[model samples]
Target: MNETQSILLASACFALAFILASLLEYWLHRLMHVSKKVGARHLEHHRNNTGQGVLWEFRDYIRGAIVLIAAMFFYSWVAGIGWLLGSLAYAAFSAYAHQLQHENPTKCFWMKMPVHYVHHKYGMWHHNFGLAVDWWDKVFGTYKLVDWLTEEELSQPEKNLLQLRWW
Candidate 1:
């Protein structure tokens, strides 16, 4: 392939990897809800309403996908690098979003409603499984809009957007 074609292919791979990561996240979260063993672990998060820190979360994501990332390199070096960057970017963003929602759901500005926050706060077992974004939830017909911020949240002291566990 020409240099231009290689670049375009890499770019396409990046975008595809980014989107695939989100879709995978949505499905994995849903799996956790349905699988008893997984749900047992996930229940701890619901009970605590806390995140395991951004870096740790990202590490977990990378750890889980390491083999897939390696397989991407076999396709092509450019594609592999692009996919790696895109997947890492999404993992980082999702980790940050997860932690932010746990610390202060109001700080999540990208979404009109932070789905994960409501999922946990409302004990929704069958809805709002998307962790990074709500696109998949909407696509799968699992998205539900509820009054997220109650009087309790409204009355609580405001928190700084960056005041989250980042370790």
Candidate 2:
């Protein structure tokens, strides 16, 4: 393939990997609601309404995705690098999103509504499973729109969007 075609192929791989990561996140979260073993661990987050810090969350995501990343590398170096970068970017974004929603849902302006925030705030078992983005929830027909901000939240002092636990 020409250099231009190689670059395009890598770019496509990157986009595909990013999308697949989001889909995996959505499904894994959904699974936590139904599978006893998975739910057992996930229950702690619901009970606490807190997230394991962003770095830890990122690490967990990378740990889970390492095998796929390795497989991609074995297939093609260019595609693998693109996939790896995309996966890492998604992991970082998702980790931050999860922690931010837990710490200050109001700050998550990327989404029309922070789905994970609503999921925990309302104790929902079957809706709003998307963490990084709400696209999957909408596509899967699991998105539920509601007035999520509470009186307490409204009354609280405003916080900086970046004021989240990173470690």
Candidate 3:
């Protein structure tokens, strides 16, 4: 292929990788809400503004590493260095954006503000499942705009959407 063709192909591959990874994250987030055991741990995440504790964080890191390595290998074979690098960038950005969205939503730039804020503040567990982007939530009819809840209200013992049977 010519150099221009190669670059276009690589760009397409990169875009595809990012879209696929985001979709996977969307589903995983939804699953965490559906399963009781998963929801319990995630509940702690909502209760504590910081994040999941060290052990769970470590587990997530391990999982991310495995996925990243596999993506690197696959994309390298399929679309050369350009796509592999793009996938790596996508993974890193997704991780950083998610952590920021949880730890301090105000500081996050790429994701829509207060979408995650509303998620945590209202325990709207099923609404905003998309981490790095809101496309899936929008596509799946789960996106909703919510005003901020008071701290006292946020602390109330409410039904988590994740704990629901049809979430």
Candidate 4:
């Protein structure tokens, strides 16, 4: 229960929780666009007419606040402020990445932005599946190119990945 031990323990626990949450996020992303119809709830997100954007998904924002508070409370009880900070940071980063990834060209890894945009447009369910970073997608082998970004489109490197977006 020394200071160093507490810090190490907290860091480990925080990393474990973050990895689990990130993995879960990948699956959740896949589910949202699983079908072309967009399911009942996600359909709202797909509507170009409503002028809704992913960042304004109010349902998720409200739910996220509650979950974040609860997670912080639980982490604080078990491992003190360090763990709470780690978990909160992880949660906030994940949510921010999800929103930013889909939002306009705000501050983000520019290289991945177009790739993800293609995924969104073409429904590349398997590719660009990771949020917060594409590290997971690259690790998991689920990364696929937008169908149009085939051998030809990639060679040019300026055709908007063609029109297939995601394969």
Candidate 5:
């Protein structure tokens, strides 16, 4: 094909890859909950460690690094630089969001940690499943970011969510 045709094809590929990546993220995010055998550990991860304390619960950072690297290598192949950049952005955003979820932010106009705080209420395991963006949660019929606490838990001085306690 000619140079123009090649560029157009690449652009199309990028757009398609972007949409596919988004869809894949949504599916994978849900899978992390639904597939007990595969993501049971990750699911327990939330139950065990809510918020920033999660990063410390992993006994082996090497295993986590290996998983991340493999994912990056696989994604960078067909998705190209744009998607790769998005992957990086998503990782950073997820980490920040996780941090924000634990403790309220002073001014969180960007990550909106307070939006996630509601999920910290009691019996909220099935809600706010998205790690990076709320789009997937909203689409997958589990976008209840608001608090789902019992009257008893809400009445307590400190909400006692079933979360991982790193303290």
Candidate 6:
């Protein structure tokens, strides 16, 4: 293929990779709750957010890193560099969004993320599994909009990303 054609192909693959990654995150997040072993480890993340420091969720971070590295290798082999790069982008975004969820950002942008916010708000381990988007959840009947929750109910968690401390 010519350079231009290759770039185009890679771009297409990147888009596909992003969609796949989002779907993958939804399934994996759901699995983490359903599977005993996965849920046990993931519980640490819940506990850490309750009162402990954010850094205490080191295992979650490490697991995400290992999975992303493996995914990049596999996606590159299957779809080429563009797909791999796209997967990397999804991985980074997923990490940031997850942290923001745990940090309990109050800003409109952070608060608007339906999936992660619902997951934390209700402590609903089985629902709202999407990371970057809610398409899959909506399709699968797992999406739970938090708009119904009263402001008082939402106050338990960090109100906004601005609450995050650098120290």
Q: After superposition on all CA atoms, what RMSD does each candidate show versus the true structure?
A: 1.3, 1.1, 8.7, 7.5, 7.5, 4.3
Give the TM-score of each candidate. Answer: 0.94, 0.96, 0.67, 0.60, 0.52, 0.71
Instruction: Give lDDT for model 4.
Output: 0.53
Q: Clashing pairs in model 3? A: none
**Residue pairs that clash (backbone atoms under 3 angstroms), model 5:** 48-164, 49-164
Residue-level lDDT of model 4, residues 1-167, one tens digit each, is 78788778777767766676566666766677676553457556445412133434333533644465356546555454544555556566655555544443234544444444456666665677665656667777877644433453335423221122121
The most accurate candidate by lDDT is 2
In the range 1-167, model 3's lDDT, one tens digit per residue, is 77797788778777876777677777877988899876687667777855443344434734755555365556445474555556566665565555555545554455454455567666786798766677888889988866554575456554432221110
Rate residue 72 of model 6 by lDDT: 52
Q: Give the runs in model 6 whose Cα sits over 4 Å from its true position.
A: 50-78, 108-113, 148-167
Candidate 1, 1-167: lDDT as tens digits: 89998899889888998899999999999999899887787888888889999999899888988887777899899999889888988999999999988878888888989999999888999999988799999999999999897886788679887888999
lDDT of 2 by residue, 23-52 (tens): 999999999999989879798888999999
List clash counts for every candidate, in order.
0, 0, 0, 3, 2, 5
**Residue ranges of candidate 4 with Cα displaced over 4 Å:** 35-39, 49-83, 110-116, 145-167
Where does model 3 exceed 4 Å of error? 37-41, 52-80, 149-167
Q: Model 5 has how many clashing residue pairs?
A: 2
- TM-score: the better of candidates 1 and 3: 1
Clashing pairs in 6: 105-160, 105-161, 106-159, 106-160, 106-161
Residue 75, model 3, lDDT = 44
- lDDT of candidate 6 over 26-87, digit per residue (tens): 88778888888877866775656532233433334446655654555564453567776777
lDDT values for all models: 0.89, 0.91, 0.62, 0.53, 0.50, 0.64
